[model samples]
Every structure is written in structure tokens, then in C-alpha cells.
Target: MPSSSPSAGFRSGLTASLPITLGYLPIAFSFGVAATRAGLGAAEAVFLSLVMYAGASQFLALALIGTGAPLAVSAVTLIAMNLRHVLYGPALLKQAGADARKKHAWAWAFGLTDEVFGTTLGVLARGQHRFSERFMFGIGLGAYASWVMGTALGAFAGGGALEGFPTLDAALGFMLPALFLALLLSVLRRAQLPLIAVAIGTTALVSWLVSPVAGIFSGMVAGAAIGMIRAPRATKGNTA
Candidate 1:
């Protein structure tokens, strides 16, 4: 099938994003439940997913909010957590390029996340799918819709649904981590092992010695610095 056709592109993107959609359901649901349990109103929980659109950040925000963290602290925490995403935009923009980077680039930028980034990168890198706004929308919208639905359900239900299911309540915290792990493993590149190692080591060491928030930011900075230092300089006729 020609990936340029709107219908074909959307369908292909949707099909490719099914697993990510499924994976997001439970995690987002948990976020909703956690948000509500943390004293946020149902609308607030849903709005978090609607506006923030960042899964882990949503959870962290709710946690920070619940704990009475000041606005500045909450903002700083989220910024630290998402420092890694700074590296994703340039690469994705380069790959998707003109195909999806015209009038819709701003909207597309809002939809970029770890899973979406990985899926887009994998497809583009393999040249299996043509990049298009419709295709990217299909993938982003599917995941976004699923996440919103899950959030609404969990926000409304709260602990009521899991009252007797203690085991299920306990497992909610695990879902997001598992999802992130799966995405990370899928996107792992052999050539990036050294960078990955440095990031992980820094994260662990700083987390133990300082704070997890500091560790996350420090880890990404350390890894990025190492990557730049080890990067091969641009040469004649070489795009890399």
C-alpha cells in the first residue's frame, strides 16, 4: 500500500499504534485514580491529561500537588523529569521533515511522547511508512483518546472500582514503569550503549546520593554531554 494516501496512512498508523494505545489505558487509568484519590476533582484529573498530555509528568504533578508542593517546586520537578525529551524533537523533526512538518508541525509537536517518538522513529528509520500529518495524527490521537477515556473512568470511579481488588490497586503503580521500560527497550540502539550506560549510572548514583529529581536531570545532562564529546565531527558529504 502506498503510505502517502491519507486513508492508507491513517489506518497504517492506527494499526501500528494499537499496542501503545492498549498500554496507555491502564497507566492513564491509574493516573486518574491516583489524581482523584489525591483530592483532585474529576475534571481536574481529566484536564491534566487533556492539557499536560504527558503521562509521567501528570502523575508526578498530581503527587506534588497532593503533597502541597509550591507551584515553583512542581514546575521544577516536571522540568527535570522531562529534560530527556529535549533530545527527541530535533531527531523526529529531521525524520518527519516536510511530510508532516508544514502547517501542522506545531500540533504535531504537542503530540510527541516517548511511545509516539519510538514508533515514529522505528517506522521512519525502517522506511516502512511514509510520514504524513494524518498518519502522525492517527498514532497520536489513538493514544490520546485512550488516555483520556481511561482518565475519565478512573477519576469517576476512584477507589470504588478497586475496593475489593486490593491487588489491582497495588498494581496500578507498576503499569507506567512497565510501559516506559518496554518503550525504552524497543528504542534501544547498540551504538548508544555508552550514552545509555552513562545516563543510568549517573541517575543511580545521584539518586542515592542526592535526590531522584536531581538525578534525572543530572543523568540526562551527563549523557548528552558524553554523547556530544564522543560524537564524530561532520565530514564532507556525510549527513551524520
Candidate 2:
């Protein structure tokens, strides 16, 4: 039932991505604003977005360029920043069947970002939505379109736009984490509550004790291990 798509499946896909679309607009706008402030022309800003389409990395690259970093160093830094994105794909791949994992599906892998990954993971965890290419397309396309449009708007608005709406800036600041938490809560199930608590507790504790990076990676690894260990028990309980 969870994997089944009804008559309005495409619409469902689009609907599922609404939160992400909303979350993307201001941040992408911020990127455009940043690009311009970094001395990039509007054309260059839009072009950078179209070519790179990487959210944080785009900002970092622009900053690096502004600082007169060498091309190779800039490239390597941007690439390194994006390496964590590799962690997003395998989980999604396992959820996809061979046919669904066709070349076309893999081709759009570039669209996968932290926000999209979390939303998709949430959807999969809920086990109530079809994770088809069309669905994934909606998730990716909606976020992509919003991001590009927002960038264009920001480019046109320039830096003053963000300043004009101070609230927008604040909202954009918290968009990613807010969206991540919202997605997590939306997918939270009673059965998974304990594990989620463990993951959250561990992440918070580690982040407080160490660095944000250490906390993030440790939380992920620890949560995954716990989930795996509990799966067999869950299966046995279900069978009984």
C-alpha cells in the first residue's frame, strides 16, 4: 500500500515536495543576493546557479572566487564540501528497484541536496508514498525550479532586497534545519520513536561535547547501527 500510487500520483509527488519548495525560495534568493555582492553580474549569478546548482557549494565557490583563490583550490574545496552528498544516494538506491533505478533516475542525482535527501528519506521512512521516478522528479524539479527562480529574483532585487525584509533573512537562516526537523517529525512513527530519541539524544550530546561535524556523523552512524540491530527484533515481533 505504501508503494502504491493512486490516480493523482504526479500531483501527489508535487504535493509531497511543497515544503521543500517553500523552504528553498528564500535561501536560493539569498544565494543570488550573495553572488551579486561577491561582484558577480546578474548574468554570472544566474549562470553559476544553472551550471553548479549546488546550494552551499555555490555560495562557497563565489566566496572563494571573491577571495582570489586559485581555480584548482576553489574547485577542490567546492568538491570536498559536496562529498557528504554521496551519503544521500545509497539509501535512496536501495529503496528503488532495478527498473526504477534506471539511468535516467541516476542522471538526476545532482539534484539531490540535504533538504531533498531529508524529505525523501522521510517519505521513504513513512512507507506510505511511492518513490517512483516521477515522484522523485517532482521533488527534484520543484526544489530546482524554486531555487532558480529565487536566484533570479535575488539577482534582480540585489542586496537591498534581503535587508528590506529582515524577517525573510532570519527565516532563510533557519530554513534548512527547520525543514529537516519538520520532515523528521512528519515521518515519525510510534514504533520508531525510541530509536529516533536515541539518535537525537546522541546527536545533541555529541554536538555539545564535540563539534557539529562529529555530532552529525556520529549520530548518523549510531542511529543506523541501532536501526539495523532492531530490525530483526521488529521482524520477529511482526511474525509472531
Candidate 3:
């Protein structure tokens, strides 16, 4: 296929993110409601959704805030929670074209939310290596639009709805972990992947017994260590 213009690529990227927007609407609405209950004003709730955009981290932070956790504690926890994004860069680099690399890297960095990453990766895997910027933008803009609208609705209406529907809130809280588990399983199809998963699980178990922040960091470190140790060695015998 011929190369696409920047605008077209952006549009394509945005359009490709449509499925993500659908999923994010409800999730973002839940976030808006949670943020409101956590003492954030409607405007602040909307702002957080737009700026942070990290669904799991934002939800966790809002939960902490509602519990009267210190700002530092919440901030640290959110950072720890998002450490997994660091692993996504190298994987994406392999798929993006030279012209799209810089812009895509930026988008991947900023739009590293779970749904966007999944959708973009699927698109790249399908041989649509040089997607229009419009595609990416469409997804981002669609998601952003849904999030803001959901947050506004949730903030304004969530409290009254919650009074009669307690189960809804609890269910919404469970979505993030469930989504992460699904994503983990998708990537853990090979034997080599299990070692890293085991390391992460072990670290998290240890951390839960001690400190949340320490546990998350320890899990990441453990995963990285296992991946490095398992990497194939380059020997003279194997050199061409």
C-alpha cells in the first residue's frame, strides 16, 4: 500500500480506536462517579480523566482519596501501578514505520491506556504499518470525548443513582483488575512468558505482605530480572 499523509494517518488511528471508545465510556463514567464521591468537583473529575487517562491508576487514586489516604501515598501508588507501561515501548518500536515512529512513539507514550494499546497493536499486526494520523487522532478524540461526557454525566447523576444501585459501583470497581487479567493472559501464551509472570506474582505476594508501593516495584524488578536471565546468550559458536 502507498504511504498515507500525516492527516490521513491520524484519522485512521483515531477511527481504529473506536472499539476502545465503546469500552471506555462505561469505565470513564464509573471513574467520574468515583471521583465525585472522592470529593473532586465535576470539573476536577473531568480534568483528571483527560490528563491522567490511565484508567487503573486513576481509579486506584480515587479510591485512596476516598479513604482519606495522604496525597503522597496516593501519588506513589499510582506511579507504581503504571510502571508496566515502560515495557510497551520496545514492543511497539518493532512495528511502527520510520516516518510514523516519532509521532507514533509520542502517541503511544501519551495514549498508553489499555484499550488504545490493544487496538493499535492489533492494527499494526494486521500489516497496516503506516496508518493515517487521523486514525489515531480519531481514536484518541473519540475516547476523550466519551470520557469527558461520561464523567460529566456521572458526576452530575452518579450519586443519586448510587443510592439505589449499590451493586453497580462495586461492579465498576472490579472492571480494572478483570481487564488487566485478560490482557495478561493474552500475552502469556508462550512458555517463556510464564517465568516473568511467576516472578511478578511472587513479588506482588511479597509486597502485599509488606507495603503496597514496595510490592509493585518489587514485582516489576522481579519480572525484569527473570526476562534478562532467560535471554539467549550470543556465543562464538552461534555467530555467522
Q: Which structure among the candidates has the greatest TM-score?
A: 1
Ranking by TM-score: 1, 2, 3
lDDT of 1 at 143: 82
Candidate 1 achieves a global lDDT of 0.78
State each model's CA lDDT, in order: 0.78, 0.75, 0.66
> Per-residue lDDT tens digits of candidate 2, residues 1-240?
664554455566677778988988888888888888888888888888887888877888887999999999999877766666766787777655452454565656767888887787777656657567666777788888888998999888886777877876897899878888897777665556656777788889998998654666677777766767786665222201
Per-residue lDDT tens digits of candidate 3, residues 1-240? 534776666677666656666567667887777787778888888888778878767878777878899888888878878887776655555445453455555663676665666566566655554644455566667767777787777887655556676787678666656655654554443544645566679677977798765676677667656655664542111111
RMSD of each: 3.6, 3.8, 5.1
Clashes of 3: 20
Error of 2 at 135 (Å): 1.2
Better of 1 and 2 by lDDT: 1
lDDT by residue for model 1 (37-156), tens: 889999999999998888878988988897899999899888878776777777776766665454676787677888888777777755678788778888888888988999998999
- Candidate 1's TM-score reads 0.82
TM-score of the candidate numbered 2? 0.79
